[model samples]
Target: MSGNTRGITREKALQLTMRKCEWCGTAIVYKNAQAVYCSSRCRVYAHRARNNPFAALRNEKRWVLWDTNKRPIMPSGAPASSTDPSTWSMGHVVNGHLNIGFVLGDGFACIDLDHCLVGGRPNEAASEFLKSYPKHYIEISPSGDGLHIWGTADEGPGTRRIENGLSVERYTTGRYITVTGRVFQPGNLLPL
Candidate 1:
């Protein structure tokens, strides 16, 4: 014991401090400090709990679109024909010069975060914002600082909330995210 009435010792406390799963209370050891759940199932359940119980039909895959001058365009550098991938090209004319969008239809949406990046990492405010939805597919935008959060949010009109260091935009339909597969946090598809 480390001078405690309950006889709890420093050794015991140290062992319990970082090795327990936050969801199931199981003992675990993780090399990554961000790990919390003991298993993906627990993680999934916890993630689903944060969302509304609305059922959504998910599409299997999505195509990336391109745009510039804040006017969205297809990957072929032409005006987007439809939100569906079938109507657009997946290749960009000037890869780095062009802004991008992801076709958002068939029950899909995304949360976009910009300007919350510092030295290839998200700042405290961005990290805090992401914690609210831990199970969504998080991708680092081509800008290397922005973030794209893809999931099954409602097809309601897009909404944007901006802060001093970050801008958060959400879109449900007729919106395509600039495509990048650089996953920061890998998890199953999110649902609403």
Candidate 2:
């Protein structure tokens, strides 16, 4: 059927190019063809509902302050609680805190893929595992050689698995994971 238009009509071709607002039920006619929402308000609602992965996590009291060494600490450089909100803050970034850590637990989990990146790109093993979760929130680790996959988990215990000589650890509680806010791939609406 190369270069053939056997039963295709011109009207059908025009209909294929028609666009609609992703948020509202209005027709879209913006100069940018990639535009999804009709306005900023619609865009915000859509982001909070689905695109923004950190929206729900911010509501919980599982935030903690971390130092540059990736250790949980208070603003005064004291040891912080990984299970308590004693040294935790509602905001991820603080005046004295160099980094922020999210206390793992409360229906949230992080799958740590250690040493998965090589020369700023995901290695063969990491790429294969990442393909299973393309829509989840993934961030580059502090060492720049690993990845952290954040998502909801069950109420049970966490597990550790080994695959392709990489350490894959999953935890729901009793631990605090560092938050680098560095996004991986684009085309995702997730706000860093």
Candidate 3:
């Protein structure tokens, strides 16, 4: 038999080490060892499933579209009320809205950290807080210098705390927070 130093032909060795595509179960031949999908279509589908980090939020009914000014508006550009369900739209609808927001209530709260980034990284206080509270869906704000930490908390009035190093606002009701879908830490919304 034609073989190399290891006594096994290269073709036989490749057959022994062959792997299957993760998405379609196809036998992957030309891809690298780290390849997961056999083709770009499979890769796209896998990414859509695994990285839809906001799937849980979309399943909820507290969604609304926002305008350029961050004000909640209906899909037809009419003003919307966070307290009014009739004005709200399903979270899954795209509807040509420039931005998306979620009404804060029903035990859900968002900790909005304003200007919490320094030199393209989270500031010290934000980093410290994230280390302590790492089990929630955290995303960078639209401005790219802040973070929105979403979690569950007791229903309460909105409160703002400003310090020398950190500025934070917590809201449990009567407000809508813009959704950027820019994830910093991927996790489920946990209790705060």
Candidate 4:
């Protein structure tokens, strides 16, 4: 009965049984007769991951490209119309360079694209890649049709190796790949 004891008494264990997931508040039950979570889903939700603000921003369509003053920058060179989905692309400011590229996938109408390497519009080369894929990720090529999409080996179809003169690491699921032509490495990415 003492609080310092390692194990709980049967009565206390029954009293402490969780009724819901601690993270998402989903219903839970001790099916194994000694378990805390009803299912593995609740356990993973409770302890597997941390909240990410960038991911939250990606989910919400409120993310925008603005200057330090919060002034929205018009996407220059964007197709006047959505006539050819292939022609539409996004730009991001990367390393002070405006490396514009088109986005691929649904629900990305409001994602801002700036230069990924220099912090401006993507150059003509990167923009061409965007025009080709129009999806979340793509490959960079010598000619057109090179969209360098950054994704992990687990979630998507194909995997390509990218070298930026830095050590490459193993890929994992749920990593954030920005349309700005940069892959947000889990630990390397700045905390939101």
- Top-TM-score structure, candidate number: 3
Native-to-model Cα distance after best TM-score fit, residue 112 in candidate 3, in Å = 0.2
Candidates by lDDT, descending order: 3, 2, 1, 4
Candidate 2 ranges beyond 4 A from true positions: 1-49, 92-97, 186-192
Question: Cα lDDT for residue 114, model 3?
Answer: 94
Compared with the true structure, what per-residue lDDT tens digits does model 3 show for residues 2-84? 84887999888898668888755689876376876787766643453354446655766888888778889888789999999
lDDT score of model 1?
Answer: 0.63
Q: Is candidate 1 or candidate 3 better by lDDT?
A: 3
For all candidates, what are the clash counts? 4, 0, 0, 37
What tens-digit string does per-residue lDDT give for candidate 2 at 15-74? 555577774446766657678887775575355447466765666667777766777886
The window of 10 residues in a row where model 2 has the poorest summed lDDT is 183-192
Task: Using TM-score as the measure, name the better of candidate 1 and candidate 3.
Answer: 3
Per-model TM-score on C-alpha atoms: 0.56, 0.65, 0.68, 0.23
User: All predictions: root-mean-square deviation over Cα?
Assistant: 10.7, 8.8, 11.0, 15.7
Candidate 1 structure quality by residue, lDDT tens digits, 106-154 = 5556788987778978998898888877877778887798888777654
